[model samples]
Target: MKADSEFKKVLTLFPVVLFGLAYMVPLTVFSTYGIVAQITKGLLPAAYVVTLLAMLFTAFSYGRMVRAFPYAGSAYTYTQKSLGSYAGFFAGWVLLLDYLFLPMINYLLIGIYLNAEFSAVPVWVWILLAVTLVTFINIRGIKLVANVNFLLILFQVLFVVMFIILSIKALVSDGSVQSLFSITPFFSEDSSLSLVFSGAAILCLSFLGFDAVTTVSEETIDAKKTIPRAIFLVTMIGGGLFILVAYLGQLIYPDYNAFIDPDSAGLEIAAFLGGNVFKSLFLAAYIIGCIASATSSHASVSRLLFAMGRDSVLPKKVFGYISLKYHTPVLSTLIVGIAALAALIFDLETVSSFISFGALSAFSLVHLSVIAHFYIRGRKRSLSETIVYLITPLIGLTLCVWLWTSLSSSSFILGISWIVIGTLYLAYLTKMFKDKPPELTFDADEDIKVSS
Candidate 1:
């Protein structure tokens, strides 16, 4: 396929709309607890501040790379160019572990929500049904997916707005919360440093799905501009909403702690004002948002597979196949659906620590890719571009390493195990394809040698 033709497939209003909604939900609801916890513990708004600063560094690195390469391969292409093929493939490979789990998380959460009302239908049934239903829709073209996302996102956004409105009504009835900030200490009186860190780290999970936009860069028209802008725009929108909703909860729900427990944890805050009725509504919203999360994940993983196929890292036939009618990856989509469903049967809480492991690792690589590219190509190239690509990635690397250390031991161990598995798979594929007609474009860089 001509590059332009392939890229054009991703150009649509649907992605933009889905992204806008995803950004809002996580920030408004999820971040309320974590961000507030971080702020209270740090004696200020450290979580929100850290998030913006961290994203700025990472986003800039992404912008520079997308403009330079502007291909659908994203991390696969950039890492291949800077770190070499093995590094690129493994970087892309490990990410599969994290993204691969998204559908599981989504479907599982959706089932739990549906159980609130439909006591008759088991939550697992709802999960299976949701995955089965969405799988066929995704098999259609991205155009249809995007169209559906636009409506789904609209409802998601509406639910959040409604919650805020209802809570505001309660606040007005009780007079005002203008002096409420004075009541809570700037620094946490209860939480230890470790507890606050763990809490803040959770926000990264909510922050992640938007990066999937890059996986489709190969299909996006004007992606070099649209993708990056969409990211920053979404972040600001979500960030502002997070801050507002946290304050709203604090203001309206005086006894906020009652809502949170081991079962619901950070989310019980929604139950306070909503009561039984509002709880049901927000619960529905949460599940729907998770479905959106699964949809976003499905779209992303298939693109990753598509790119891997292009590099001949996977069975070129399956991963590389695009539906002529839909211009989407049919087989890869099916694979993602099946894999996600498989994860559902697992007791993932035992493995949930590893969930964000590969994603952070991939983000780390992306940052380093920019630095490495400039460290090599910069001296012979434009100085400003070099600084944009290299310096920003260096900052991103520092932030990522800091966040990496903050991960739990369980996560670190599971993450490491996944990498080892990826290495073995790469070697097996390499040997199997050794006699094949097409060969992978292995990097010439000596530094990128595969461990196998």
Candidate 2:
């Protein structure tokens, strides 16, 4: 790759924020609404509140790290630079669970919704079609994916607005204006702090976009400034939207048990609010948005694999190879597509648990990275510096650990299995820790971009 062919610093704050929001897929609040509502017993908003608070602190840590190392690789780079290559390799490995399975989650969602609406078609067929389409588009190039995601994101935002308005209107029609105000969404007799924390653990998937923006640091202008600002903005805006939509949805339909299908509860709510027409529109928009999201995640994990492979962390020939014709990581993209086929076996809730586990693990590592880099290594131990570097990150790390406890036993089993596998691989790669693990380099020939 020529120097001139490298990533251009053309992105500004607004576009970067849009990219982050798009990656987040704001409508995802609906995707997990029913499951979370059931888990929290109608305290979805409170769960989101807990999640938002956790993300805010971690976002602060991410900002500090980006200032120190303004590049791609996100948490992996931060951990490697601050800690050691072995820790960093594990960070990237664990994070790969989040990145690799996210597309699978979207595929699972596509199958769930399309199968719900069109029962004649098998769910595997929809999953296959989605995987093929997303893989094809991603293999083509990133520019086309970017343009498509922009329009998809606009439609998703529009759908969320319409859903909120319709929910409010239904609330008013059902009772008086007072019907719109309810404490039950945040607190009810059945709701407990433990349940809310568990819900928050699942909902952490909704906040993945804030950290995703850090991957674009190398491509953004004034990335140290722009990326941090984008992270905070994305987290706040996305969290607020999730909280509001969940609040309104809960207010409109307090009886979570009434839904025929918990996974497709949002569709039932849409149909109740408007009619079949609105529900159809909701289904279409959501499927389209999931496709866009799947494409973005597919491309992201592919590039991450390319980075690790280029560093000889993975097999250089397979994982690191880029297609000459398309100028993309074709092999890695196909691997991700094949992995996404796991959607056929896994259900939405289980897959979400897996993603949340990976995400929470990475978040914990980032907080530790901040303390390692700024508080311990830099040694800026003034009272203010200690608070900024030590106290804040410690708080973030604590919250992340608390959330981890809330994850299901299945998540812990699967997550630990992944870690054990990574440990063995790291041992072999480094010849039993006698040599440092190969560090991943994010800036390389392959294009690293993400879209919704």
What TM-score do all the candidates reach, one by one? 0.85, 0.92
Residue-wise lDDT of candidate 2 within 140-198, one digit each (tens)? 86655666778888899899889988888887885679988878888888889999999
> Which 10 residues in a row give candidate 2 its minimum summed lDDT?
443-452
- On a 0 to 1 TM-score scale, where does candidate 1 land against the true structure? 0.85
Shift in Å, residue 434, candidate 2: 1.9
When superposed on Cα atoms, how far off is each prediction in RMSD? 5.5, 3.5
lDDT of 1 by residue, 275-386 (tens): 7777667766677677666776777788788777765677766787777667777888899888877745765454356656776787788898877777666553467765
